[model samples]
Target: MVKVTFHQDPVTLVGNEVKVGDNAPDFNVLTNDLGIKSLADYQGKIKLISVVPSIDTGVCSIQTNRFNEEAKELENVSVITVSMDLPFAQKRWREVNNVEDLELLSDHRDADFGEKYGVLIKELRLLARSIFVIDSNDKVTYVEYVHEVSEHPDYDKALEEAEKAE
Candidate 1:
């Protein structure tokens, strides 16, 4: 279990048992297209999974757009945005924002993805902000659990970590 805090208050999570250099955990998540996808779908590719509370908010949109612009240029790289938002909402956000590069996946249906990754916020119908980077071999290499729910992550550092994994 991982102990994280929001506004200085502690919350607990049963984090994925997988560790750095270990095989990445695979789970299915709903896509904006209303399709199920798994980690194996992007096998042998470098990936950055961005877990956010919601995309309708300003901060989420900014982070999504930032990574969408920066990440698309890299070859064999998959940048995914995960949220508790329904697939419909995800699609709308992507369409309205012209978010073509970053794939938005939803955990509203089953939320197994969040549960497996330990990002599910139990008290709230949201997912904790996190960044998980997996390497070409589908091994976890970098991870960050944003302790505060109201803040943005260190995108620069996360990108650097992804680059290192590449």
Candidate 2:
């Protein structure tokens, strides 16, 4: 039950708290086309998962776009952005922002990703901002649970770990 702040107010996070060295949890998130994609879908590739409350928000947009830009250079890494936004909204946002290198997934159907990753904001039905770096073997190498939901994550550190995992 890790706690995070949405706007300087405490919020509850539901589900298991993931940590480095833990086997990455598999979750069924909707792809842009409404197809299901789980952690196993990315087997054999290092994963940089960026979790945000919603894709339309300012911090989330910047965070996702930064990773999308970086994804072009991370050849062996599969960068993904997960949010509670609908699949339609996720696709629209990606197209509007020209974010092509990363996968934008929706956890709206079920809070699977949000719950399994310990990022679900109980009161708001949104996910807390976080970053996860998983190695090719599906073991978590780095994890960042951003204390403030509106702030940015430690991108450099997460990217470094993803590169090393590759």
Which consecutive 10 residues in model 1 have the weakest lDDT in total?
Answer: 11-20
User: Model 1: runs farther than 4 Å from truth?
Assistant: 14-18
Question: Top model by TM-score, which number?
Answer: 2
Candidate 1, residue 12: how far the Cα is off, in Å: 3.1
Model 1 scores a C-alpha lDDT of: 0.84
lDDT of each: 0.84, 0.94
Clash count, one per candidate: 0, 0
TM-score of each: 0.92, 0.98
lDDT of 1 by residue, 44-95 (tens): 8899989888999877888889899988776678999999999999999899
Model 2, range 83-114, lDDT digits (tens) per residue? 99999999999999999999999999999999
For candidate 2, the TM-score is 0.98
